[model samples]
Target chain A: MKWADIKEKLRWCAYLASEAYNMPYRSTVARARREQDDLFMLLIFSEMMGIPNPATYYTLELQPIMLERFHDWHTRMGMEHSPLDGFRCC
Target chain B: MHRLFDRRIIFVGGKGGVGKTTIAGALALMAADGGRTTLLVSTDPAHSLGDVFDMPIGNEETPLGPNLSGLEIDPEAEAERHIATVKMSMKSLVAPKMYGAIDRQIELARHSPGTMEAALLERMADLMVDARSRFDLLIFDTAPSGHTIRLLSLPELMAAWIDGMMSYRDRSRRLGEVLKVFSRDQSKEDGFGMIGGSQDEPDDSRDGRIKEILMTRRRKFHRARELLTDASTTAFLLVLNAERLPILESKKTLDLLSKFNVPVAGMIVNRLLPPDAGGDFLRERRLQEDEYREEIDQTFAGLRRIYLHLLPHDVHGVETLREIGEAMAEQLGGAFGAAKAP
Candidate 1:
């Protein structure tokens, strides 16, 4: 093999090695991110989910932007039906 | 030393039917007559500014007199406009099929109780930031005491909420960046992938747009809260009748405004019985008023107070409001100390 080919192979080995070493940290981060995202979705859609959010007016503008993602969010959270009355994402 | 005429922003608020609109209009007239450009805005949904000015004053600024302008805010209309604007903004983020569902969602939110107040407060905040540059005095004839208090308190509440949301976004971004885990795997692996963004489009702008919106709103709310709480620049003129309920309500309002650091410039005691009317019924009513006035003096001690007598004439048109304005001249103008309310 050419010298450049050997160097490229070595670089790939190092890259994969680093990724493997950081696997535990990556999983923990992924879990943390999932939890954070769940909390955030809850904060924004708590009113829709039947939680009385006193600050609903302040969050109303964010609803349209979050609508498309609502489908994915509810389904991922195992909601059989859309929690909001008259709003069917399915 | 808060002078009524010296403040740039004034909110005239009180219990319903306490002549807050008339008082606010009178103050605006005085400011205009003093050569200060004035805008009289009514945030009360049951608007009588048009009746007070005897002219059609809508949402936009309409010239009432020389250097005086009027605008009446309709909370329901504002709420509709707000929803429409949000819908327009989300057009690119939503699919054509999802429009009906999204419209229904926003429509439900529009009918919510706090929605009207929120709309009114947002318009008030917008006026505060936008009109401060053009007008020397911005007089807000707010709704009744309870409604106005909620509107005033919302600026700080909204600012804190936006701040919390932005900080959360920042922390989440930092977590990904610091861990060097910012990858493109979410679109492929996660169930909660982005909504309508194209695959070729970078993931940064969606959250960036939310951050931008949050930042803009935060600045407006922060500026509004700053202006409202700044005792030197803004003053809340409390108007109330010399009756029992209004007096008690005014005391509660005073406490609430003080707690929020919103300075109460003075009190205008409306509809006091005149002494010259000599009848047994009049005498008894005046006696009751005298007692309430005493309570007012005790409750609102150290605050400059203006006492206005019951006028048989309707407080309409420039001539009537001018009469009320002149009555306020002595105590409020500070230039004319001996004059009294008619």
Candidate 2:
């Protein structure tokens, strides 16, 4: 009825429409992102899984920044423990 | 001798205990004696340069003689230094609390396979680039055949690995940027901006810290690869004894180096018994050595050959090394002269 109230209601409507439009795409993107992150972690920490890593010395510096992501990645990959968990090598 | 003198870098490789260090030292001594400033770098973990020069030459370049300097890169020390450098850079990238865990991981990685070799190679790359302007020549007295081959091949492997990392980083960063815009999260965008505030360029946004690291390493490896593969700048000399196994191993090594496109400068046959030795035992060994010598000349016919006689005593200190150097200089005369022709 009032101009101010109309503007607020229209804003809420737009917000809801945007959310509805983005949900499916966001989920798909999120799934893809998780997969990519998993792949990245594998590439970096493959040596921890007994793979012969030629660049392990170069990758050691990255371990600190990716620790949490590495933990989550390992857990999601169905491992009961992190590859470097007990020693916290990840 | 002329080609080797003209080249900036020389890698001496051979079977274990083949007196590679001795021959490499002699070459370096000869180069230095010719008024060229030569840096002899021993990459062997079991360093004998100190013994060869009979001096306490550690990691630092110690003056072995006029225009000659010696450096023995202890693998363990180099590995520790490399780890410390990585950790120092990582301090800026990670939180304080994460240091302990990351340090532990790095320590484990230090002991991991290939870490020593990688560190040694990194040090070598550093020397090659940094010492290019400082010295007339750099002679690397490398580890045994297999180890040296692997070390030489590392630049290519490192290049491939860095390329993969860079592509992955690029993809991840692009996706992250796209997600940030699509989500329209102003707070998250501001957070990223704050995190990367140390860098202000728009180009900085495209490359994360890891990507920058990968790029730097790629560049280093690229330069090293270029230097290593260049026939004019680099030469790999095979050192062998007048023995069957050394001959066979040298042949195998030459094949491998050729496969890697590494330039084989020549072969040095060390510990040749004198032809006129009078003792029965010495004569018997000399007879056996003659057979292997013939095989070596036949097998490596195309390669320039240098022969050093088996000394009556152990070759230690500068005097004997000088003697060996004089012999090598004579043998290398035509080769070095020919190299200067073009």
Candidate 3:
């Protein structure tokens, strides 16, 4: 999946989690989700920005697992109606 | 002053991002102003004592005001110290070949569940006994409420474990001594003495000194629990703004604390809209403030309530702290004054 697609899905997942917890979708939730996505993107951006990935680097192999966990968590929490649900590429 | 104050340890704890440090610091100042020598120590791993006081408070105690000092205890440093103590004790008994394995075990012991709280409790117990003569009051600016409870409960949990270990240690010591005597090797005498130096060794002269210290810690825990429940000695002044999210979180925290039998002493409604006559924006803000203030009062009923006007800038430095302190003192009714004698 492309980075943009992953970002969109994660944002939806974040909103779903917040809604499940009965938290308001205010600036705090937006900021928290944005921060989490920013962290996720920073690592990939670092690698693309000429940072060396040694033999132990396995970022490519972990993307599917991370997405699966996010999907599993949302599904288990009964948050299947999120707008970005059908956007998963994997 | 109540006799409970003499043997009490006060721990101020709440959720993170709540103004626990500020309230703890202000209470210490109030106690000092009331002529009690108070030591406010932070047991939070992520400390904000320096930020709260706007002064450098390293590992060692730094004087904040007359009769008031603050210390920030670093849990990592404490864990290291505990690991070393355990390694030294284990080295005296286990075979030389097993020393490396034993050392690794001691290192891994730091990662065990509740080890952080246990080590912190041991350090606190030591400090309480060591400073028994220096300070009259010990105020802990504890971590969030969950962590604080875990830390406070460490003494009882550790005492139970110590009881079981003491019997095993005593048997091992006797067996080592007997083996040494049969071998007739005086060189092993000193080695066998090491195993006998467990913490349970009863001293005839001091009688129950160690037991007294443990008992004092247990009493301190009970006293802290009481003060938290009692509205007089301790007051949980929650600092919350007039926002829905923070208000909800504060109310939830109050509910949890009440459920756990920890009293909500009072609520400090911070950053409220001023009563200034202004445009529509100000009017809307004022309406929101009124709504939230009513919500706070209704949610946390049966406790004293105070409102603090929103300040333009962040509260920092001694000067700002003093100004905020004065404002808070006024709202809460003049610092050390009796709580309306109701």
Candidate 4:
């Protein structure tokens, strides 16, 4: 076999092995990702939280995209001792 | 003089009631009369273009004369237009059951204090980008110094703010893609019922629409900052009378503009006392004016200073603007050469 072909095959095998090793931690990583998103959304809505952000106008375009996950995000935030715990969206 | 008119973009600002609007109008008219297409824009909320031109000028572009157009930006109206756009996108993405709540949220945002300024800045960026191809020169008549300074400084602040948001977004987006690949089936099995879990991953991944929107805005602000700081193609002019307050205030404003890297062209010493005013009281007033005038000369020796004597009447009508324009052209290099660059 050519040296280049051998090197490519080895890289593919290493990638698969790393994927297998990361399988168990996948859920934790997902939860962390969700928390990261929640933090980002809070910054966008900081004005509504009584923090004055002049750049709030720039966040309006992202509102619709986040609308779907907001319920999932905010409710978890409500249990995590956030100021949003007592806040009602409606 | 020749250098001032050669710029592609010009901003006129000073203390309130300092005749900034008049100077900006006359300059725009002069550029147009010189056969260079020009646009005069008023960024002051209390617009006087309608008063200055003796015609109704609202948010839309209105022709002042041959090769000249004017626009008065109404911040409230601009904010409304922005809300309408947000509402359109929200209506499609939000569920019908949640429409009322989303509507109220948007309405609250509309009433926020900074909404108008945000909208105005966005509109200004749009004009700067859109008019690059259509006009030979653009002149902005800004509000009094403080407000204009705040508005001009926003692009730098906003660009930095957006950069922080962009880096955070990039991290989250990559994590999202990883979750889609590794935990998709397990998330379903865990019974953690996210309505979006079953749906397509397009909000931050797959589609990446917000990245495009953010990129467009970041690019616009960068371009606006570049144009504002370019001395060869952009210049900031201050219009003030020969008075103590105006002179002191102009010095402070000039310092601020220089710190921001904006090129300060010079000042127009408007409403000067005529030498021939024959009266003890008038002559006394003239003596006071000369002291201030001398002070201005000493303070701003490096700047191009043009002194305009007080006109006999309140400046009005196209004929009046034309006369002032001619004086400006005569003093601004004595004769405006056909100089422009893209």
Using DockQ as the measure, the top candidate is: 1
lDDT of candidate model 2 versus the reference? 0.79
Worst 10 residues of 4 chain B by lDDT: B333-342
Residue B327 displacement in candidate 4 (angstroms): 2.3
TM-score of chain A of 3: 0.33
The interface RMSD values of the models, given in order, are 4.0, 4.2, 27.8, 4.2
Candidate 4 local Cα displacement, residue B283, angstroms: 1.9
lDDT accuracy of residue B37 in candidate 2? 97
lDDT of 1 by residue, B142-231 (tens): 899998998899988888878888777777666555344433343444343322213223336656766777888899899999999998
Instruction: Select the stronger candidate by DockQ from 1 and 4.
Output: 1
Instruction: Evaluate model 1: give its lDDT.
Output: 0.79
Worst 10 residues of 2 chain B by lDDT: B191-200
Which is better, 1 or 4, measured by lDDT?
A: 4
TM-score of candidate 4 versus the correct structure, residues matched by position: 0.86
lDDT of 3 by residue, B141-240 (tens): 8787667655544544544533433343344344434433333332333332322222122322222332343355456544444444554444344556
RMSD of each predicted structure: 4.1, 4.7, 24.0, 7.0
Q: Cα lDDT for residue B262, model 2? A: 95
Please provide, for model 2 over B1-342, each residue's C-alpha lDDT reduced to its tens digit, 9 standing for 90 to 100: 776789999999999998999888888988888899999999999899999888899989898888999999977888898789877865666678777766776677877998888889999999999998999999999999999999988999889988887776667566555554446642332342222122224424424666767778899999999999899999999999989899889888998898889999888888888777788998898888878888887898888788888888998887888899887777665634231110
Superposed model 3: Cα runs more than 4 Å off: A1-90, B1-9, B124-132, B149-237, B255-260, B277-282, B334-342
Give the per-prediction TM-score of chain B. Answer: 0.90, 0.88, 0.69, 0.90
How does each model score on TM-score?
A: 0.89, 0.87, 0.57, 0.86
Which portions of model 1 miss their true places by more than 4 Å?
A: A1-17, B179-202, B332-342
**Winner by TM-score between candidate 4 and candidate 1:** 1
